[model samples]
Target: MLVLLLLWTGCGSAVPPELAPDLILHNAKIITVDPDFRVVEAAAIKGSRFLAVGSNDHVLNLAGSQTSLVDLEGRTAIPGLIDSHIHALHFGWHITKHVNFSTGERLTVESMVARIGEWAKNVPPGKWIYARGPYSLDFVAEGRLPNRWEVDAVTPENPFFMNMQGHVGVVNSYAMRLAGVTKRTPDPEGGKFVRDPKTGELTGIVYEFPAMNPFRGLIPRHSLEDNLNAVRKANEVFNSLGITSVVNLAMPQWEFAVLRQLWRDEGLTVRWTAMLRADARVFLNKPYSEVEAEMRALGPPTRFGNDWLKINGIKIVLDGFVEAAYMREPYLEDIFGKGWRGILLWDRESLKSALRAAGKYGIQVAIHVTGDAAVDVALEVMDEVDREYPVAGRRWSLEHAGVMPTEENLEIAERLKVIISTQQSMGWSIGKTFKKWWGPEMGGIFAPNKTWLQALGHPYLKAGSDNRPINPFIGFWAYLARKDVDGEVAKPEEALGREDTLRLYTSNAAYGIFEEKERGSIEAGKLADLVVLSEDIMSVPEDQVREIKPVMTVVGGKIVFQQGS
Candidate 1:
């Protein structure tokens, strides 16, 4: 026992004799989220890393004069939550700087217009009016996006642009005129300018990123201070929710730079894994290759940056959510017509070229795939690349694998060793609407968490909030209940147990960002990223999971947030 104690205490080695754990938490349930999913009594942290995890007695022995002991009082502790896919930059900008349409009551066109008008009143004239999100198509009375004329009528003098959660955008006439976009202006490749069917007049509703860019570029960029504040505010939200780490879905280069600056200034509070976006006209003014060259020249390869900020991979939006996921089956007849299969944002050759380039650079690629057809194309390209470039170590992932990943596709995903990162929380908000739109057969499989879990298990399968409805608890509830907001069970058999669901947000998410060894679980020598919950989420009544809140959030062994303190 003396020898064991000596070795554990760093005795007869490099110990300075005075070194001891800075903090310790004991007398509570600690969900380790290890391979065995052990639940221990206590944990000790030395500096930024976990010192030991065992019984309260064992961990207490590691404590010294400087140790700050915390009696958990039977509260439950788990690994700090990891949001696998969130738009931290956009989410921050929306929450801090833009007019948030999600905060108030049900948003009709009048209400939306009223909100915009109210916001317009506060800003100086001629300053571009920008609103980031309020992306619910169901909220509008017409079941369509807000019209340009409605925005024109409200914010007539100011050039206005509202980005609707990546689906589409509404731009006022002033904004359009500023961008020189008129009825005669040709629709850019990979996007559309929504026009009236009869009159051919531009409807002011822009579809996809490429098309929205012309007008969206007219908006003035936020000041650096605004950017910093936005990140800080977003970090607070994450800390409050027990999220210590996030894989930002598509952060701009400028925002990434801001985060790096924050890290240098000791302002970054959360671990950020950025999936750099190569969207045309937004961040990249040149072709994809030029952008790739710049990124390669910029020092860090995938996962090369520090603990706080790392560039994980590149984000390629293969298709839009609605009307453009490249489906195998013809979409059920809609305005586009019968046999209207969706469109792919990039052609097969172009996508292959991009994948090859990423592989050459040794950077990982995260392709946004929604349709099964898109998945099929992705698999083919990956298979081809594997034969040539051999991406076994790259950890390339398919983001938002979409609604229809057939068993064959799942097998291919597994065989090819690509990860499927999806957001099940989408079902809670958009499942019923999609079910009605796509018909039962197609829409029933929205998210398909259970199916993916059954096939890939927790390791290859990763879950994210996607910020569609950013509440992680709501995501937990959705997975457990397997039901949408309207109490409709899309696929009950696909529901997961509480433990598996927890793994989705914890360990699996860590693997998705290629940081599985660094933080995800409660383990010795790992970063002391943990959350103490109001209740044991594992043992709570399945329905009560959403009710449980984080009582404490600890990052790098520092108490970042404490309930009531």
Candidate 2:
């Protein structure tokens, strides 16, 4: 019956001649996220590339006897999803090792300490305990992080470190002592060691990665096999969610090796773009000349490796996130101190010089500028470097421009051709805290999706999940609705149209990694990476967007995931 049906459909008088396809999917709402955003009836794939796309009659004519035909029966098919920014290793390790406290409801001092106490029972005495958080200072009933003494009460023998959203960290006394971080230990450059004002004692709260790295360095990483297994597990999850490509950020050389090995071993199922970190021990604390020489040794600017795993570029953190972000204006209330805006992790001259050095090596740089002030600094740095290099297609990205860029700054970004790789997951998961910390005025303006769309337009603006919730649907829902957990809208005017939001994670994302021409859309000649969804996301009710699931995810014309598989 299948062969008979194909014979009837494939034989058409006056049909244009076409090549045979390895696979044919018919009766689908093929959302070709192309320039015109065309929707077609069917698509045909030949050996990892899209063979033809158009009405069923056109595509079916391309199918041969060997073509594996699939009748979608009116399912929605889209380009396989892309996560523009994620810490794959960190996410993988966390998923395997720790319990998540990102939901806000489970983020109290009592609850965290109790969970730690329970976890300590299994850990050997004097061993390290690490916990990852989506924690905020506002989430706790006390409106502050728990003290070391409080954490100590639960695990006096076991040293513990709670990593809070990559910005702040809480350490028990045992952990502090292990690192020898006494009250006399001076604050590191570009980082703060929170201390009690009255007693001048260490509060055990470490702010910024620079400050936390000393203690963090003491923890032993998982074995190579374990890390690889964790990444495999994470990829399984990513594939299940229709994520075919991810730009994994802040990857040091070692982690990149692991991912490369996974690809070589055929264990990698998702396309990975690893952005090298500048602060790896090899570059950190080194003179500019040394760092430049080291980066130059890494090879050329063009992406290296095959479609599965490739080196994207360099990543650097210029500032913190959330309330710790270095802002031009002070927060609604002074939480750090009087005149406390936030921490500037690099001096203007040093930052400019570092950027120029990276540019000299022809390396694409991705800067973590979570604040508007930091965004300005990053733009200035980019401008300086671009002038020095006089190169086009630099495509340096600004990761997590948390605050909405001013019109003038957006214009600067356009002029510089910088990609705005921001996230909507932050709003969906932490919108309430943003309001409480930054006040209604600034918090409501947090992402400013609509403003960005109007200013920078579609091609330059790409949305990332940041892995807080790790659900792209939540990112989709966040951008479309702009609503908090309470259903209170934050800058409802900034909500994006459904098509624009979809592009944020699709074609624009491909553009971010300079893969726009190769994949990202269900167009003929593009790589056959696509997803079949249970519901049509474009026309679905806004609230129902989050509940939509991928029935199948195909990468390189191979089905990597299917519902119930």
Candidate 3:
């Protein structure tokens, strides 16, 4: 019957028919992440959807005379990669403008100071010297934190700076004085101000919200035009990595305005799903009517709004980074035996109330839960709220489900149907530090991907690059292959198989964003978002997976990225 339809379409003329298809790609290996996870050799595409998928000959036979053809030359193709969790604005902003501390041979305070001194020579004074991407604790045994004095030495007139793990930052004495933070300055409700015990002076090392707020205020506010430029640069980088879709976590209203402007100007080149940052109070109030009104005014969520933008849900940051002492877990030994178990953004009651409201309104919630204790609390809140509101179809996600929870908690997550938006790349990037700080017993509990997969029974979505570089391919390579970027296998036992890894980025990630039916996989009726890679990921040696480059990226039947072109 299928053959007959193809023959009839071919017999009429070279062209299949109007409204049939405008393009057909043949002679290729297409890994369609459909229900059966089919691997087809060719496909037929209309304006923005796949018309058919099967043998090359069958799809080619249905091609109309005017149908543009692409011969894949036996290259490998899969669904367009989606980075399920990334701070889109932050990622773009930092990459283009911030002082990158990731470049140095040694990521220490002293090394960073030297690097900034060099950067200061080229940059003018008085302007904020923004820098990011340094892991201070990665090298030193005591793990020396950079103080304002260290940064001041590099650029005393200029405000020298660098972020700690991209979550918090340290500014020089100049910046601190400008911000008016002094020894007497009390810590903000959700942030911290580190100080020297002897001198009673500000240390310049800020932790969590308090440390971040003041500095974020110091940076020059971006104009609408500047934001648009940032968006363009972001898209260029995304295309270079073959990323077709991204969920921009915690997009502010102001930034959304700029995105809208870009949409009107037709300047966007990447598909985005935005999660608005709902601060604690706003979210607790259950401001559904107001939020809905705002969304309606902004317009409905566009899957591929001109193939460049979309809005999926709302983001709620429940906790802070574990290493920064913002996590709720009890530290074994605090400095001077002064225990600090981190700060919770909101009380349990407030969290439950907000999440319940969000669930009732059909808005998906992406909660940041990093620590084991924090995860337990977050899960309890979700479970309690879910029981009351009974969200039938909403996909609630637990971002940064990094630390291993108790088996009972894992079972609870599976039962509650919560999606674990995890960072698989952390195994390679942050795993080392985890081993050191946590010791053997706790280190083993950090990011137990294999354990979660086994316990969850295949429902969790592996989707996070929260503070690291956003690259799904690299993530897949690391998680499945258990190898570093240089192809050195780390922990083979924790490795997921190739097929499961693909699902993590494709169907699993799509399900997390509530866009499973529209995107995520290649099916007859789904949007044609796909990527062509240099090698077959499944067939390659585990170590070499990182070397595979994306040769092409197509979204809605239009080619968005082509390697070296």
Model 3 lDDT per residue over 498-535, tens place: 88888888887777766788778888878888888999
- Per-candidate TM-score against the hidden true structure: 0.90, 0.90, 0.88
Number of the candidate with higher lDDT, 1 or 2 = 2
Task: Summarize candidate 1's per-residue lDDT along 380-421 as a digit string, tens digits.
Answer: 888887887886657788888747577778777777778888
Q: What is the Å distance of residue 396 in model 3 from its true position?
A: 0.4
Local accuracy by lDDT, each model: 0.79, 0.81, 0.71
Residue-level lDDT of model 2, residues 288-323, one tens digit each, is 887678778754564877798888678888876776
Q: After TM-score superposition, what is the CA distance of residue 375 in candidate 2 from its true location, in Å?
A: 1.6
Candidate 3 regions off by >4 Å? 1-13, 16-20, 102-111, 135-146, 184-192, 195-201, 281-308, 324-329, 332-337, 444-446, 481-492
Root-mean-square deviation of Cα positions for candidate 3 versus the true structure, in angstroms: 3.8
Please list the residue runs of candidate 2 whose C-alpha ends up more than 4 Å from where it truly belongs after superposition. 1-19, 103-107, 135-146, 182-189, 193-203, 280-291
Order by lDDT, highest first: 2, 1, 3
